[model samples]
Target: MKISMTVNGKPVSAEVEARTLLVTFIRENLRLTGTHVGCDTSQCGACTIHLNGRAVKSCNILAMQAEGADIVTIEGLAKADGTLHPMQEAFREHHGLQCGFCTPGMVMSAVDLVKNHPNPSEETIRAELDGNLCRCTGYHNIVKAVKAASAKM
Candidate 1:
């Protein structure tokens, strides 16, 4: 199947198998390896990405399903000048990640969370993050980072 989509602010097209997951298309086809596939079963949100301005688990959808959709991987979250997104900076400033494996999806999810809730409380942040799992940091700093980023965002 030939899939065409806007990725990381660039229009791209590639030939992919029907069974190819969106995560594979992003990581293997597009070479945007920042979107991790921590759990192929979709239990983990490591493959989360923005699908048309909304966050979705890339691993849960087929590459063809994303046809012509606007996609944004973690690599595209920053500005062209190389400035980190406010959420990324908050993750760094608050030490939100430890192993870094789940940081990308976590950051993406947080960005969506804040978009829906500009002033999310700690409990709201925790609840909204139910889909994303992080083995490290115990979510203490992660929650803090989300709150911090919400203020800046």
Candidate 2:
């Protein structure tokens, strides 16, 4: 199948198998490696990306499902001048990551979370992050980062 989409502000098209995952297309065809493929079964939110402005796990969907969609990977969160997004900067300032393997997904999810709940409470942040798992950093700083970024975003 042939899939076309706007990824990270660029229009992209490629021939992909029906079974090709969106994460695979982003990381392989487009060479955007920030969207990690951890737990391909979708148990981990490591492959999360913005599909049409909403964060979704890329590993959970076929590439064709994103045809003509607007997608944003972790690499797209930064400005063209190399300035980090507010959420990303908050994560770094708060030390929200340890292994950094799950940072991209966490940031993506946090961005969506703040979008829906501009003034989310601690409980809301925790509840919203139920899908994402981190083996390190018990989520203290992650929550803090989300809260801090909310003010700026």
Candidate 3:
């Protein structure tokens, strides 16, 4: 199938198999590997990406389903001059990430969470982060980062 979509503010079109996962399309075809594929089953939110202004696990979505969608991977969050998003900055400042394997997805999820709840409490942050799992950190800093970003965003 030939699918066209806006990815990272650019128009992108490619031929993909019907069974090709959105994560594979983004990582392999589009060469945006920041959206990790930690688990192909979608249990982990490591493949999270914004599809048409909402976050979804790319591993659980088909490339064709995103045909006309506006996609934003972790790479798209930064400004053209490379200014990190507030959430990204908060993650760095709060040390939300440890090994960095889950940082991209965690950051993506945090962006959506803060967008939805601009004034989230620690409990709200924890509830919103239910999908994303970070084995390295116990989520102390991640929660703090989200709380900080909620104030900024």
Candidate 4:
């Protein structure tokens, strides 16, 4: 099957198998490797990306499902001039990541969370991050990053 979509602000099209997952298309076809495939079963949010305007687990959907959709991966969060998004900067400043495997998904999810809750509380941040898991940190720093980024965003 052939599908077309706007990825990272660029119009893109590709030939993909019907069973090809969105994560495969993004990472393999597009070569945007920042979106990791931690768990193909969608238990881990490592494959999270913004589909249209909402964050979704890329491994959970087929490539064809994103046809004509607007998608944004971790790479898209940065400015063309290389300025990091506030959420990304917060993650770095607060050391929100360890092992770095889950960082992309965590940052992506945090962007969406802040969009929904501009000034999310610690409890809200914790509740919102329920889907994204980190085996490294205790989430104290991640929560702080999200809270700090909320103020900027």
RMSD of each: 0.8, 0.8, 0.7, 0.7
lDDT (tens digit, per residue) of candidate 1 on 56-88: 999999999999999999999999999999999
TM-score of each: 0.98, 0.98, 0.98, 0.98
Which ten contiguous residues of candidate 4 have the minimum total lDDT?
Answer: 129-138
Task: State the lDDT of candidate 2 residue by residue for 35-144, as single tens digits.
Answer: 99888888789999999999999999999999999999999999999999999999999999999999999999999999999989999999999889897855999999
lDDT of 4 by residue, 29-148 (tens): 999999999978888899999999999999999999999999999999999999999999999999998799999999999999999988999999999898898878559999999999
Error of 1 at 131 (Å): 0.6
In model 2, what is the error at residue 90, expressed in angstroms?
0.3
Instruction: State the TM-score for model 1.
Output: 0.98
Q: Summing lDDT over every window of 10 consecutive residues in candidate 3, give the lowest-scoring window.
A: 129-138
lDDT (CA) for every model shown?
0.93, 0.94, 0.92, 0.94
Error of 4 at 29 (Å): 0.3
lDDT of 3 by residue, 31-149 (tens): 99899989788877999999999989999999999989999999999999999999999999998888988889999998998888889889988988999988786599999988988
Worst 10 residues of 2 by lDDT: 129-138
